[model samples]
Target chain A: MDNVDLLISRFLGGKSSAAEREDVLKWINKCPENRKSFFLTKEIWEASSICSSEIISEETKQWQTLAWRIDGLLQKEKIIRRRILVKQFFRIASIVLIALITGWSGHSLYLRIKSKTTNVGYEMVIASKGQVKEIFLADGTHVWLNSDSQLKFPTEFTSKNREITLEGEAYFEVKKNEKSPFIVTTRTHKVKVLGTKFNICEYPEDKIIETTLSEGKVKVLAGDKIVDLLPGMQSRINTETLDVRVGQADLDVHTAWIDGRYEFRDKPLEKILSIVERWYDVKVVYPAEMKQMCFSGVIKRHKPVNHLLDVISALQPIEYSISDSEIILKKIR
Target chain B: MLDENELVRRISDSDHEAFKELFLRYYRPLALYARKFVLPESAGDLVQECFFQFWLNRKSFIVHTSLKAYLFAMLRHRCYHELKKKAALQHYENDTLQRLRYEEWRYFETEESIFYFDLIEKTKKSFDKLPPKCREVFDLSRQRGLSNKDIAENLQISQKMVEKQITKALKIFRNELSDFLPLLIFCVSQLLLVVIRKVFF
Candidate 1:
């Protein structure tokens, strides 16, 4: 119980004036003993703060929520393991049967099927709901895959070309190589590029596949149409009609997810909720009337889903109830 | 209770019970520690993220120090990332630099933070020995973050009395700490040896 000890205690309690705080800091910097003693007192203060029942109850609730999420992850992993095993068995069995009928070696037939599928030596990287994954290819191309998306790429690129297939959404920074062009194939369109940065968003449920270029050049092909896109340009291909439309790109809206955020500008509530669903890994059920309700705001992807819904409800006349895995939204009268 | 090393070994073996035990013990304290830097709402998420990451990388996660030290270090790293991200969004250069300076001060002082793990248990035991009124006053000052004057007025006590109780509580904590002084000296000497080797080698 010295004057400086009291000052350090006041500082740790966040009650010291700025001058007093500076004095405490100066004392701590005076010697290692002073620093150690300050930290020791600070720890006793913090540990005593945890002895209250309020914290224990809060701790129990938080643990349950975290435990539930961990359980879900474990379940999903088990299912993925089972699915891979079954798929591998079927793949090998079919390859053997086809080889016998065609009078070819099993190894050669396996190679033929692999080449036909274009996945012979490819590795699949998946980003589950509420998660984002980054992958680096052999050619030094970087991809930021969005949630609920998968990318298939070879372990090493062939001398002639660098190719990858995308099923959901990804942002790419392709390494520049003139001799071997980088190409990305989605279900609806194929994008060819050479040393460029771009984002491709083509979720299967969406009606359009959009590619936004941030730097350099890219050529997007859909059906028989080929369009060259410069930086600050976007190409949207209609999944059903195979028509391509090029327009000025909104870089913020397209690439915000890379920074763990989503920007919506007066978009329909339905569209926003769909993105929110993927962002939180939770299903949302709402009345039909609210479908056309438009929302315009930016939502951070790392926050709890309730925080997002609370902000939305404050702006609009709506009420949302959250369950274990679903959010039910009701229109407020 | 299982030892810290034993818990880590079991965790790497994917023993859910060991993970749960560790989470139960550390989650609250870690979350409270994070609140020193982040908003209350985001602190829990940040802590949970660390646990999830630890689980995912269990096989490859190496602990050169104790598990408690390793976890606190990880959470501190995450908090720095979070602060930088917010700073990036605001794009305020001075504000970012100011926050970084403040954090760096604590970062340098944090080596002794890991030493508090066992001290915390001993402190909790000593807490129950404090007079009921003294414990209440200290809780108001520490847990509720109330000023001495504010706590005095709220509890209808004098400001001097409030300070006296808090001072008394600190005395008990220091006495408890003295019991661990020998152990602390040994640990510090070991750390100094390692640092000396690295610098001279």
Candidate 2:
């Protein structure tokens, strides 16, 4: 063994004979290097020992604190989730009451509309500017429509199939029914799902129709072609050619609006502004020949549209104008 | 002015005052020693834990020498266990011990044969620069693992004088070692960065 190792062993072994100990002391005195090594090792060991002791103890204390805090947070989360589930339960239970009331007061009106309608069980819901609506389908599917969007579905689905037509964007949580397949038909393609939750965005002016699947399985169909998707997957369909591309999905970004937040993950400047305009019921126009920008973050949806604009402007040099219902953006060169 | 034996006895009897005295006496040296092997944030925690353990298990304490050595031994054992736990968690890469061994072997065979010899020479020069009696006392106490009493008996000095000299020596050594801090920090930071990267990404 080297002199340092020998010195360390002699110091720590704790059973050195008197003669051996004397000999080690003699060696230490004879050479300054041996003494230096000994002192250095001792100093290092002392430092290491003290440090590890403190770290373990401090971590233990911090862990206790964190455990308590996390317990309370988890309890709060459970309560919130439970409350949401109860609200949904009541809402579903009250659907029968709504149906009964509509049937009782509007029987003649339904007869007039039903005689004019060639298709049975087909219903269309359209929301104009500054309008928000919620729909509870016969199959227990729930949809929340943003402003200026349109959704078409059947009042009651057939035993074998459930389908809907879409224009613009809608968030959906389909009730699980394996015997009957649920499909959403957009401008360019169809999303066939069996007990899955997803969002479909198919605005007419937009060039792309995006479908983001949050859970379960979904199949995106374009004419005879089909593409299957798993959870955390997104399928983007080109409105012009109906070509489809699949990629990983960021659920928090896609579903943030439903949770009263606007989340963007590297989205183009144009796309973000359009979403902001629709959700806040405003119009945003940018400079005609400016460079495009992309951003990734979350903003409170309830915040004024200008607040979000200010945040974006701080990231890059930009200016904006807000009128009664119109907002314009310009790049600062 | 109480002797080491009395201090240990009082500590073992759940004497908070004595424990606090022991803690204050050894806290600096132990913290400095621990900072050599662990991150600064963790070093403080380790020192605290060592003292806590010492207090918790004081009833079973056994000491044949200065309480300093016993506490040092406990801290060393805890450090080894901490390193072992870290090594276990990082199964994909070479551990610090293995890397040190490999470097030592390579040093023995390569043109860097005199590299460690040069380091030893530089270290010896640094030691020679210290106060003579302080160096002598530190050498005897550390190299031979002698108790302060034994050091006093052999060097023909009082035990209190020996402790004083040793404390002075440690302070000088800590100041002198500051130059090596950057290299030490780099190695530890690299290890931590690797572990964090693996776990998070």
Candidate 3:
């Protein structure tokens, strides 16, 4: 038994022969106590090797930081949820009001987009639910508008510069003209480029306005902060904080909507479901647990919303039930 | 004081108290474990982030294993990611060897490793009870990875005396830890009971 102790110590101290190592392994497997002692000794040995001298001080500080973050996040989550509820209520009320004023049927209001020339000599294009629209500007720029989005532009390009207003998401391939810079204005940001291919997303419900440049250079201006984004770079502007973050852009994921697919890499389920809600025109009601659960895959836009839900349910232990235009997700034991 | 399964359920239900309980229970051990793979400065951040993410994904996080095991697994994954990021940023030194060593530890990882912080504390208490000379000899052998002969020579003691001290230390560890095991098993079984009830219910 004492010999076994020596062997175990030798093994842990990195001085054990191969034969002694095997012997120690056999003894550890011999009984639960042996295994426990083996682990206990290893834990002590590893703990002793930690070079940090200020462990206790650092631990208290870290705990405080975590506690503060948790408190802040909990408050933020509650506010965001309440805001979302209020926004949804107003959205439904406005839709009903628009339907009444235009004398349009409810079905038509739910599914049809309108592009009208206003008396101010500007064109306004709105993409309805479950629809994607492509438009060609007079300056020869091509724009692909995503579902539930709005784009406003002048009927003709002015001599100084071409400027347009957008809400929600759009992918643009601008016609190059050095003299005339193309500018897209959204609620929180303005993207300026001489001529470049890029994707901009600024959904009103979202907290961020994301712009991904695929080709050429573009300048993203959030209030006074201006950042030049080169090809394959993305900029995220926080609408509330107004902080801008720039990073390497995943072009495929950003531009996948133009190709009739939603390609995501480790994106949260809540974010994906929100997009799904826009694409399928359904209201998703999921528990809070879905917030940080992530999924990665290609979801074809042509398929029914059930196809995407089925894919999610298969990968996760979640069960879903669909009503007329509402879906409920529940955790499955 | 609730069982892990109950705590997870409550956390999924957005019970902040349950989340706090879970964090306070696991934070020290997880941070210690993460320090094995990454820098000490990053270790605390990594573990904290893991807990935050765990809380956020509580509803969808279906644990096929023990919650302790799952937490360690997530921390390990995050440590790997952090190492990869650091390697990419530094670009001068090759972190492949460090990464390989990090991967090697996965084999020896037991769910029991989560008890490291408590075990080490108890071990230190028991160690303090030992005679000073015996403690010194054992510390040299374990902490510095010194050979028994080298320890004996460093302390100007006979090699046989060094061996005897180490054996004595191990025997005390065996006894001290054996007395603690039944209690550990009882707690573990209680956790298992909660998990079984959750699964079958």
Most accurate candidate by lDDT: 1
Q: Give one digit per residue, the lDDT tens place, for model 2 in A1-333.
A: 244344344443344456655555555556545455444444333432232344346545644543454446557867999999999998987998899888887997887778656455578898675566788999899898866799998777854789889888888899999888898887678889889789987877689888999989999998677999989999898877878899997888777777678787887887777777777878777875542578887767667777888888899888887888888787887
- Give the clashing pairs for model 1: none
Show where candidate 1 strays beyond 4 Å. A1-43, A52-58, A95-333, B59-64, B90-93, B96-102, B109-113, B116-119, B144-159, B178-201
Q: Where does candidate 3 stray beyond 4 Å?
A: A1-120, B1-201
Q: Which ten residues in a row have the lowest lDDT in candidate 1 chain A?
A: A35-44
Cα error of candidate 3 at position A208, Å: 1.7
TM-score of 1: 0.43
Off by over 4 Å in 2: A1-121, B1-201
Which rank order by DockQ, best down to worst?
A: 1, 3, 2
Tens digits of per-residue lDDT, candidate 3, A44-160, equal 555544323355556678778877887898899889999999999999999989978777575566545332223226799999877899999989999999999999998888548
The backbone clash count of each candidate, in order, is: 0, 20, 0
Instruction: Give the Cα lDDT of each candidate.
Output: 0.80, 0.66, 0.79
Question: Which should have the higher DockQ, number 1 or number 3?
Answer: 1
**Model 3: per-residue Cα lDDT over B92-130, one tens digit each:** 234444543344334325554555555656766777777
DockQ of each: 0.14, 0.03, 0.09
For model 3, name the residue pairs that clash: none
